[model samples]
Target: MKAMTYRGPYKLRVDSKPDPVIEHPNDAIVRVELAAICGSDLHLYHGMMPDTRIGHTFGHEFVGTVVEIGGSVQSLAVGDRVLVPFNIYCGSCFFCARGLYSNCHNVNPNATAIGGIYGYSHSTGGYDGGQAEFVRVPFADVGPTVIPDDITDEDALLLTDAFSTGYFGAQIADIEEGDTAVVFGAGPVGLAAARSCWLMGAGRVIVVDHLDYRLRKAEDFAYAETVNFGQVGDIVRDLKFLTDGLGADVAIDAVGAEADGHVLQHVTSAKLKLQGGSPVALNWAIDSVRKGGTVSVMGAYGPMFSAVKFGDAMNKGLTLRMNQAPVKRQWSRLFDHIRAGYVKPSDLITHRFPLDEIAEAYHVFSAKLDDIIKPVIVPAS
Candidate 1:
């Protein structure tokens, strides 16, 4: 099997590796047909996440065919085409029973925070991801969903993570009808969130980012207003001005540790590793929303202390909601939306690469070159 392996910061390559086998009774081995390089994967590529060992494969969004299944995996069988959510969890766990699949207590050593995530760093769970020809899926019954014949492979691939997380971000926002919703970052997740906000009854949606290309996607793909933070003097102030001085009704931080607005914060956190993740976008969310509004965080951040504006959030009576998205929880609604033609997840896929060219794909995505909004990896059979 050929898998994308992480060597060090800014280093990645597709290398031949041993194929994964079923290790647990509930495990299943999937022959990956399509995989995606998520924005969060960049954290590992750039050495932002802790304990991302060398040779670790970094991918979470994928759809594939089941080549082998364990005895206990009764929900699926060989030859089933499935979209595996990023979360790896036991169905009957304390958190899983409450629909908090991302925080399942029975999966990761650090299950106290986030559950097992495919191909994330050791902090989440040291499981190999599907950035290869094959991947072993644990708790297969609870996570992998058969891809409907009506849905395209690329759409199903997006549903595995980016679209699901984006929907979850909007779901947690509790957006009221006619409320103005503002999303930070214009990556796939942000674009999805912005699009989902409209479905959730938001009167207006605005996407904020520093890149013209992504901001353009936000406008075209999500039908939302765009703001380039780099062009503005103060992003929070600009957001407030756009919202007519009171500020937006809701603000979401889709940009996590690698946010670029604050120089000192980005340097200390992203460059120097002094903090968990740069909280610039989160802090901006706090400042950009109106008093008593909601701030939802869907961005991926390391498990270290970040200098967040807790005091200000408390003072303003803001509702701060954040978590690793329970991906499966959003599937039902997303499926309906996709079927209704309200959103096309595949439209955001801007590039595709063969597994052999994964390094170049990573470079293009990490460098933000070629207008690559989302890049998919196709493993040769």
Candidate 2:
């Protein structure tokens, strides 16, 4: 098997590795057909996430065919096509029973902060990801759903993480009808959130980002208004002005540790590792929303301390909701939308590469080159 391995910061390689076998009773070995490189993966690629060991493959969003399954895996069998959510969990756990699968207590013994995530650091339970030709999926009955014949490969793959997380962001925002919602960042999650705001009955949606290409994507793909934070001078003030000086009814932070607006924050967090995460976008989200409005955070951040505006949020009576999205929880509504042709997850995909070119795919995505919003790895199993 050939897998993408991390050597150091800004470095990745495709190397031959031993094939994984079923290690748990409910485990299934899946031959990865379509795997996506998430923004969260970039945290590992740039050495942002701690304990991301060398040679650990980094990918979470994937759809594949089950080549083998353990005896306890009764929900699926060999030859079933499935989309595995990023979360690895036991369905009967305390949190899982409440539809909080992302915080399942039974998985990730090292997790006091988060649950098991495929291809993340030791902090999130170090499970090998689906970036390679094959991956081992534990708790097979709970983690993956059969991909319907109507769901295209790209749609199934996106639903595995990025798209689902974005929908989760919008779901928790609690947008009222005709409310103005503002989204920070124009990445896949941001774009999905912006689009979903409309579906959730938001009267207007605004996507904030510095990149012209991504802003263009937000306008075209999400059909939302765009604002280049770089040119706005004071982005928070501009957002208020756009919403008639009262501020937006809701604001979402989709940019996490690697936000680019503030040089000092970016250098301290993303470069120097002085802070767990840069709170530039989150702080901006707090300031851009109206007092007593909602602020939903879908961005991936480190477990360490971040200088967020907690005092201000309290003073303004803002509702701050954030968590690693319970991906499977959002699937039912999303599937209906997909079937109704209201949402197309496949549209997010922009580039595809073979397992042999995994390193180059990482470089292109990390560098934000070639207008690559979403890149999928097609590992030949």
Task: Quote each prediction's TM-score.
Answer: 0.95, 0.96
Q: Highest lDDT, which number? A: 1
Stretches > 4 Å off in candidate 1: 259-276, 303-306
Global Cα lDDT for candidate 2: 0.87
lDDT (CA) for every model shown? 0.89, 0.87
Q: For candidate 1, lDDT tens digit of each residue in 84-106?
A: 99999898978899999988898
Per-residue lDDT of candidate 2, residues 1-381 (tens digit): 988988988789998999999998899999999899998787787777779898898888899999999988999989999999999999997789998889999899986657899998777898999899899999999899998898788898999999999998998999999999999888899999999999999999999987788889999999999988778678889988998899999998888777322232321223443454767788999998999999999988764366789999999999999999999988888989999998998898899999889889988987789998999999975
